[model samples]
Target: MIPHIHRRTFGTGSRPVLAIHCSLAHSGAWRGVGAALSDIATLHAYDLPNHGKSGDWDGQGVMHDTATDMALAVLDEIGPVDVIGHSFGATVALRLAIEHPMRICSTILFEPVYFAPLMADDPGFAGGYRHDTAAYDQALEAGDTAAAAKAFNSTWGDTAAWDTLPEASRTYMAERIHFVRDSAPFLMNDSADLLAPGRFAQATGPVLLMRGETSPWAEDLNGAIARRLPNVQEVSLPDLGHMAPITHPDRVATHVRSFWAAQGQGLRSARL
Candidate 1:
């Protein structure tokens, strides 16, 4: 049971919006965006099973199971919700909508990472993701916190600004890093080669696949996702990158609101 926690604020009768966080970040990461959404929604910001208040993450399968369990926990508490996810959380949101089509009104996925073919695989990118996962595990086990932090800073090595984060920030990211699969080797060994896009084709709701203008997708991952989804709404943030949702909360919120407004009754009438 990966314990999922949520922090929320909003009006009672407004549309319900649930924001799921990216890897490592907890519910607190949504504070800025949640506040924006609250103006027109009853927003709920979720914390991954072990990352925040809901600290127990023990679950059946691998990471996907943890994501599904967290979704169930959220639904149990609030009945149904309109979901929004960032990075890895986007992947979770898609999975939950597929597994529990009746529990979600709509979904917005911002650069979901579980899918790999979308990334113009440099072969190096895949190697790096796996390598860093292992390095972090090794550092954690050896109690070398600084090494762990340095490894983290380099994981997203391709990101132009990742390496520029101050040493203190890197240290902080390192100190707080949590890896259920130790390092990259474990990650590669434990997970599948790539997330199966077909798994989500049957989800009974509209999917808004978004990517930042300067994202590292190397190609049209958003378009690929759109092709796979039954009802897809695709958008690209013009003046932003992969971190746009965090850096530009107002824009992200506006995107969500606009997309929701455009959704016809067909989405609202879905099981969830």
Candidate 2:
């Protein structure tokens, strides 16, 4: 059964667009970017299960699958639309484009955390990533949810320190830290079968893959994804990190607008 996802619409344009936020964030994270794109496209953003106002996960099926299903339900309701996602959300966007190409007009992926490709192709980086994140893993194993959340956030979160965050924010993260573990099967192991041969090549539409130049693993991971895509444009934002979409939405939206415009021009030329 498709879970009831909580969503909020941004922008006032007729062209529809879907924006998926990264893990540990809610639909509101897209406010800045969505507002920036409001002139040309209406952006619809949703909170994943157990995040924001959405209901809790029943712990029944693969968490990633459940999240993807929630997004799919929204897509079906909104019809074919350009989709944008960040981090884990970007993985969902990629899957939707690859598996339901007919339903996606174009796609923008902001630092998708599809680690399987890198793990298989570059074991050195994979090892380094695991080594860097071992503390978070250890905390999870020890059943230290708060410590796990702090460790995870220290690495992937914004430049702010964990202790600097508001107490409520810290509490929120601690409650959902288990999602990091629940997401491992798909993000780390390719449980969704997204890497199966010929699957990525199936998304023939124009794709814009954006990453922050400062992000440690984004270049490598996005590079891996770019190699498999038939049509893709890569952009590296200066001085930004993995959380750029949330931290610097206006900057990200500038590139988004440019990419969307370029695609529009190409479509017009093709029709001509």
Candidate 3:
């Protein structure tokens, strides 16, 4: 069954861009970045299943595949577009660029949580990541979803304190925390086979891989992905973390603009 995806558009620009938010976040999460890029791109973001107003995942197939299909539906409607994604969404964006290169002109990936590279190239970092998230894993095992959510957020979320977040935000994260676990097969194990020999070469267009300097695992992971791509530029944002796109949208947008400019796509005035 096709999940009913809820989409939101931002910006008034000639370029069509699909924005995919991180896990546990809805399409609204792109508002800040979208506004920042209003002059150059129109962002079409969608709520993944079980997020925002979208219907729940029916558990019939791989959740990552389902999410990718939902994003593909949006791509089909919009025609060729540049893609931007954060965290888990970045993984989906990468998949789209690899599998549907003709439909994607470029891709900007922010802190994609594809850990398979770490396991292969830097087992120590992968082991450390597992150790760091052991508490979250234990909480999930114990059926303490709230605790798991807190643990997960503390590690990957912006510098905000869990207790400082609104009660509603906490509840929202807790309700969707299982997605973190459910995504393990793809993120940790690379169930999608995205790293298969010659797969990264499929994306022939320019690829911008950005990550926060403060993110413990981002540099190594992005490095692994960058090494595989043919035309790739890697940037590390100073003082930013995994959620830089949300907490520091303007800074992130600056890099996005620079990347496009480097590719000879200059910014244009927003469409009326």
Candidate 4:
């Protein structure tokens, strides 16, 4: 059975946009962006299973199962709608758009950590990835949760950012490291066509891909995915990094709202 998903709704606009947050984050991550776009869209921000108010998912950590639950949640609560997601959530959004094409009208992804295609594109990348994973595994094996998180965060976000986290926040992230670690296989090792070059023909929708200028890895991944998408627009935010969604909502929201505005027009034309 699919588990119940916890969500927070914002705005009263007729058009709905479902916003999914990245790992280590909850629906609140969308608060600022949602508020900014509220004038044009009714945003439904959800907490992924085991993230915030959500309960444990009955299914295993397989990403497709999680995507199924997420798709169902959209069907049950909001029906087919446009979507916005970041990092891990952005990866799931890719699956939903690919597997359930009719359900997602449009998509906006920020730094989607879909690494499988990258590995496929460059075999040498795997060596570096393996080396990093080795370090992360070693820290975990040594029962050094802090070290593990530091290693993980340093790669995804920034090493210095981990030290800047508050003690309580660091503790919370350390506790949930297992979920983060378990998702790596699905993100980086999956063999699905969604991760293949030029395999986005199945995802029939307008797509907006956003990346921070300072985030090289994410930018490269986004670029690779963009090349395959049937319909896509790419944007790079100057002086921003992987955590732009959390740290610079106003700027992020500006780009998102612009996309939705264009999408809203398309929706209206379709209704005519």
Give RMSD (Å) of candidate 1 vs. truth.
Answer: 4.4
Residue 103 lDDT in candidate 1: 84
Preferred candidate (lDDT higher): 1 or 3: 3
Tens-digit lDDT string for candidate 2 (104-125): 8889999999998888788788
lDDT of 3 by residue, 151-236 (tens): 99989986689999999999999999998878888898888888788888998888999999999678888988888889899899
Residue-by-residue lDDT tens digits, candidate 4, 1-77:
65667888877777788888888778898887777777778878888877788776654657546754765677566
Query: By the TM-score metric, which is better: model 1 or model 3?
Result: 3
Worst 10 residues of 3 by lDDT: 263-272
What does candidate 1 score on TM? 0.76
For candidate 1, lDDT tens digit of each residue in 1-272? 46535555544437777778776566776767777777677767767765556565563457556665666777788777788888767866876777677788899999876545443323456665555478766886798876765665455332445468777656545645654342222123324333455655657687888888777651355665566678888888886777666778788889887888888556666654
Candidate 3 local Cα displacement, residue 89, angstroms: 0.5
Per-residue error for 95 in candidate 2, Å, reads 0.5
What's the CA RMSD for each of the models? 4.4, 2.1, 3.0, 2.5
Model 4 C-alpha lDDT versus the unseen true structure: 0.78
CA shift of 34, model 1, Å: 1.9
TM-scores for all candidates? 0.76, 0.95, 0.95, 0.90
lDDT by candidate, in order shown: 0.66, 0.88, 0.89, 0.78
Q: Candidate 2 vs candidate 4: which has greater lDDT?
A: 2
Which candidate tops lDDT?
Answer: 3
Clashing pairs in 2: none
Cα distance off (Å), candidate 4, residue 91: 0.6
